[model samples]
Target: MNIKTQLKNFYLLQCGQFVSQLGSKITSYGLILWTYDNSGSVLSIALLTICTLIPSILLSFLAGSISDKWDKKNIMIISDSIAAFFSLIVLILLITNSLKIEYIYIINFILGVVDAFQNPASEVAISLIISKENYIRVSGIRSLSNSCITIFYPILSTTIYAFAGLKLIIFIDLATFIFAVLTLIFLVKIPKRIYNTGDNTNILHQCKIGIKYIVNDKGILSLILFMAFVNLIASIYNCNLQPMILSRNGNNKFQLGIVTATIGIAGVIGSILVTIKKESKKKIPVILNIMMFSFSICNTLLGIGRNYYIWTIAVFLGNVLVPFLTANVEFIMRNKVPLEMQGVVFSARNTLQYISIPIGYLLGGVLADKVFEPNVYKISFLTNIVGSGKGAGIALIYIVIGIIGFLGCCIFKLNNDMRNLDN
Candidate 1:
């Protein structure tokens, strides 16, 4: 295909994915609202995230190999179909008033499993469709979709949930799922992978090849490790943000929604800049600098600010830098890795980078409940410094996370191996 034709195909695919993602996010937000309303425990929320992450991490190695060996389009369709089926199951349970919190956990786990295969396939498909030169711009456009979803889904879900109910929200999800599937089947065309006729490797061996590739590349290994640490801090920050705001605002979900919306707006702005701006030649510096600023500024503001206004500002600033960071990292990977190996290599990269997320979720939840929440009042200095309140302990945790994240950036910056990726 010509460049213009390829671009057209990718845009169509993005549109379909965008619609599907919006529906998924709507359901996700609705579920969070329901779960929090029922349990009122940070650990419960943490567990929900952990349930999803664990399966994705465990299955990633296999999923990557499968994506490389199988048809990417078929994999995505099957995954989406399975996810829709699960959503149907949830809907039935909700209608019958049998939907328990534990059931949601199960559903999330299944979705996570689907995502392991789906993600790698999707990444490789993008590589197939888009030329290398446009990787950064396309990444930014993808980020824009994500950001738009972030902004829209909360508003959409909250409204539907309030006026109609979770049933209606789920129904909308099903409709979007159908639209996405149809679009994929009819509107987009993904080029076939060019395989070597002599190469006959089992999926398991391909998985090893993926791992070996990363292990042998010191620059890629170090960069992935740095991201893993970043994920640790970022996950903790994400896990606590909702609960903290809810606690401080007397379970005012609107306040939380507003903060989230601000983040999306900022992300949209950032993504726009990333789309128009030239790709950075020094991607390592862009990645590291953005990480340092994001952690230092956003967390500190969130740690100190007691109201939604401050939360909005903090998230906005923090999220705006994220697209820049994300585009650079993606550019580095797409530029360095071969198209045929991306399915497996990207999957391996995900396994390493996201492995810490579950740990962060667990630690954040445990510390919030067992340690920080209980002891914030007792620490006179801490109480005096931040002022003890509903989310006082969580606030303290944010500051600590910020400090750790900044220090991580510094350490990564000094790594010769990671810096070499810039070349």
Candidate 2:
């Protein structure tokens, strides 16, 4: 099949991804709230986030190397099946009334380990379906699909959990995974699963080769660093949004769900915009501006008060910039790397970009409970302008973080090297 046909073929995989991820988003938010409410310890929930990522860091190099060696299609199928089973097992635990914080950690950690394998394989497999020029389109579609889940999962999951239970949510997730698997069986068409052997070497050497590949690419490495800093800010924004809303004590699950899902809804909106936006290398600088300014504005508004409705509006707006930034960033990376080395390059990028996520989780949880919510009750000077709501007092950090993140993005424009690339 041609690349165009492959595009049609793999739409099912994207659909499957959407369903599986939607299930995950719902369960994860529910689990976060459950852990916090039961233990009243945001730190515990944050620790769950930290533990889940540890596996990805440790195993990513090997995962990237293996992605180059294996049948990409089979790898994804196995990964999906295992993850589906993981959700089912969690559902059983919920049914037995044995679910706990430790259980959440275990499940997420396993998913991370599985994802280490899945990410590189999926990236490479998509290339098999599409030619180089069109990978960005496929990726956009995939990102849009991801956004769809984000938009729907929280509201759907929270409402369902409210009426039924977490068990039902997990079951819904399982069903989605099964559907994804079946869809892949019928829709995705990978004609051959062969890797070039003219450059064959030892397995140990393959591992080292992957490592050396990223290490040697200065352009790739620098972009990875830039992303790490940006994502650190992003991670803080993410981990704090729920706690920020829930700080008032009366935050219903639905409110929390909307807060959680708003960014994704924005992403869905952003992805749609990408489809129509005229494609050009120059649009990238505009995207960076959007990232810097929108996030700055979001943090500024978030610090202004404890108004959930207001913050939701801010996040929804920020969502537009984020997906635009993300899609373009992926496009840049796809263009920079060679096919054979894309897995290692991409995984290495992820490893570096994700370095601060754990830190973000730890700091956000601890600070919200210990620092910001406690003594900073009347954070005077600037943020006190709207100091009327429950969380209005400690809004300075939000503005500070947002400003810092925006500045970081701005510096990207000042650098002549990155901007000169497509020229």
- Best by lDDT, which number? 1
Candidate 2 structure quality by residue, lDDT tens digits, 153-240: 7788778877987777777777777787787777777657555322565555666666576677655565677778877887767666
Model 1 Cα lDDT, one tens digit per residue, 115-228: 998999898889889998778778999999999998988878877887898999999999999999999999999988643111588877887888999999999999899989
> Which stretches in model 1 have alpha-carbon errors above 4 Å?
194-199
Clashing pairs in 2: none
Best by TM-score: 1
For each candidate, give its TM-score against the true structure.
0.98, 0.92
Candidate 1: C-alpha RMSD after superposition: 1.2
lDDT of 1 at 385: 59
Clashing pairs in 1: none
Model 1 residue-pair collision total? 0
Q: Least lDDT summed over 10 consecutive residues: which range in candidate 1?
A: 192-201
